[model samples]
Target: MHVYYYDENFMYMGEDIISEYDEMPENATDVRPKKGLYLPEYDADKREWFESASEEYIESLQPKPQPAADVTMLKKQVAMLTHQVAQLQRGGTS
Candidate 1:
């Protein structure tokens, strides 16, 4: 069965399996809401916060945008090739 955990102040931490956790942390306690209890504002706030946080986390997991290739490196390679071609035209002597 799944169990929800909370901090000492009754702030919800998260849910996990009691078998998996085995022992709760010193500063944490098991939390079980009363049957039929409902808090619309708290539910909405938590849902919104979780949605935003999930989006941000997913974005962070994505590959970052790479920077463009260096123009200076391309220029140097072009210069080297041009010199090599010129030598080839002049009877292959570098």
Candidate 2:
């Protein structure tokens, strides 16, 4: 059997395989979320999974924006210094 876990706010925690004879956890259910376009939430009253739009979840899935252009020169300088240090450690002329 499979058990779906949820937090107090009914947010999804995760899921796990459980023995059919095992007792269900208080915050767990037998319901499984259907594969969908949006995240799913367990509706205890309906005993089913309902799709819910989650901005936080959607944002987290997205790639973070790159660092500002102003930092690029500093990063390049740091990299060059690091490479020089590595060469010095290897007894190679920088």
Candidate 3:
């Protein structure tokens, strides 16, 4: 098992290779954070965030649902009207 060690401030320091039966380190806590939500990686230059593989896999499996057909038609109509209004403002024909 991978033993994740943290600093005094609870910031991730690094990891250790301890046997499964080995006692937990003083600076380390086996109480892992709850799953879900992006996890922050320890980076000195800049902080980085990462989504778990399971989350990514699930997201890939489910693509974003497209807007409803009526909504799409309405959007098209709004665009056409907006174009017509702009043309009128510029003293141009329809």
Clash count list over all predictions: 0, 0, 0
TM-score of every prediction relative to native: 0.27, 0.54, 0.33
Q: Is candidate 1 or candidate 3 better by TM-score?
A: 3
Q: Which structure is stronger by TM-score: 1 or 2?
A: 2
For residues 33-76, write the lDDT of model 3, one tens digit per residue: 33553443333233332343466766777777877997899999
CA lDDT, candidate 2, residue 91: 94
Tens-digit lDDT string for candidate 2 (1-94): 9999988877778899999899999999998877863666888999988767777887788898877885898899999999999999999984
Supply the TM-score for candidate 2.
0.54
Q: Candidate 1, residue 80: CA error in Å?
A: 0.2
Off by over 4 Å in 1: 1-69
Candidate 1 TM-score to native: 0.27
lDDT of 2: 0.85
**Ten-residue segment with the worst summed lDDT in candidate 1?**
40-49
Write down the RMSD of all candidates, one decimal each.
10.1, 6.4, 11.8
Quality of model 3 by C-alpha lDDT: 0.62
Top TM-score hit: 2
Ranking by lDDT: 2, 3, 1
lDDT of every predicted structure (CA atoms): 0.52, 0.85, 0.62
* lDDT: the better of candidates 2 and 3: 2
